[model samples]
Target: MYQIIVGIDEDEAHAKLCAEEVVGMPGDGSEKHVTLIHSFTDNPSGASATQLAPVREASDVLDEAGIDYDVTESSGDPAEAIIDAADDVDADLIVIGGRKRSPAGKALFGSVTQTVILNAGRPVMVTGVPEDA
Candidate 1:
C-alpha cells in the first residue's frame, strides 16, 4: 500500500474532488494509507464548523472507499504544513486542492499549491475547482 498526504483546506468541494482522485488511483484493490491534513494560520480555541467541514467530507470519501486514513491539523503556513506532513509520513504522493487564481492575485498573495509543488520533494497531484462547481 502507498502512503499519501492529502492537503485539504476550507473548500469542501475541492477537498472531496481530491479525495476522489486519490481513491481512484490505480492499485491492486488493496487499501492505501492516507493522511488528510488541514492547516490553519490562526490559533483558534477549536476547529470551527467551517474549518472542519472539508475534513469531514474528505474523511467520508475515504471511509466509503475503505481506505485507511487519519486526519492531522497543523498550525502554520499552509504550504509548510503540508510539506512537513508529507515528510513526517514519508508519503509517496501528495494531493492538493486549489482554485483558479488570477496572475496578479497569485503574485500578490503567493500560492500554497505552488509552494508545495515546488518543494514537496515527491510526486504531487493537484485538483482544481470543477467547471460546474
Candidate 2:
C-alpha cells in the first residue's frame, strides 16, 4: 500500500487543493491511503482533528475520490508535528500547502512549509495555497 501524509492548516481552499492532488496521484484508489495532520496552537473549543474545517474539507475530497484516509492531530509546532506524523505512519510522501513568498519574507515570518521541506528526510509535495488562504 502507498501511504501519504497531508498537513492541513485552517485554510480550507488549500486543504482541498492538496486533497485533489492526492486524488490524481498514480494509483487506483484501492492502493492508496492518506493521513491528514493538523497542529493546533490552542484548542479553546477542544475540537477533534476530524472536526476541524480544513480537515473535513480534505476528507470530503478523499471520500469522493474513493481514497482511504485517517486524521491525526497535534497541539504544538506544526512542522514538527507533520514530520513526526509522517514518520509515525511511514508515509511515502508528505504534502503541504504554502503561499508564494519572497526569501526575505519567509526568513522574517518563518514558514512551516519551508521547515518541513528542509527537514522531512523524505519526499515532500507542496500545493499552491489559494488567494483566500
Clashes of each: 0, 0
Regions of model 2 farther than 4 Å from truth: 131-133
User: Best-fitting candidate, measured by lDDT?
Assistant: 2
- Predicted candidate 1 versus true structure: per-residue lDDT over 1-133, tens digit per residue: 7999999888889889999999899883255899998888875567743358889999899889888888888887989999999999899999998879999999999999999999999999998886577
Per-candidate Cα lDDT values, in order, are: 0.88, 0.93
Candidate 2: tens digits of C-alpha lDDT, residues 26-49: 989989999999999999999998
Off by over 4 Å in 1: 48-51
* Deviation in Å, model 2, residue 73 alpha carbon: 0.3
What are the root-mean-square deviations of the candidates from the true structure over C-alphas? 2.0, 1.3
Global CA lDDT of candidate 2, please? 0.93
lDDT of 2 at 42: 91
Question: Could you tell me the lDDT of residue 72 within candidate 2?
Answer: 87
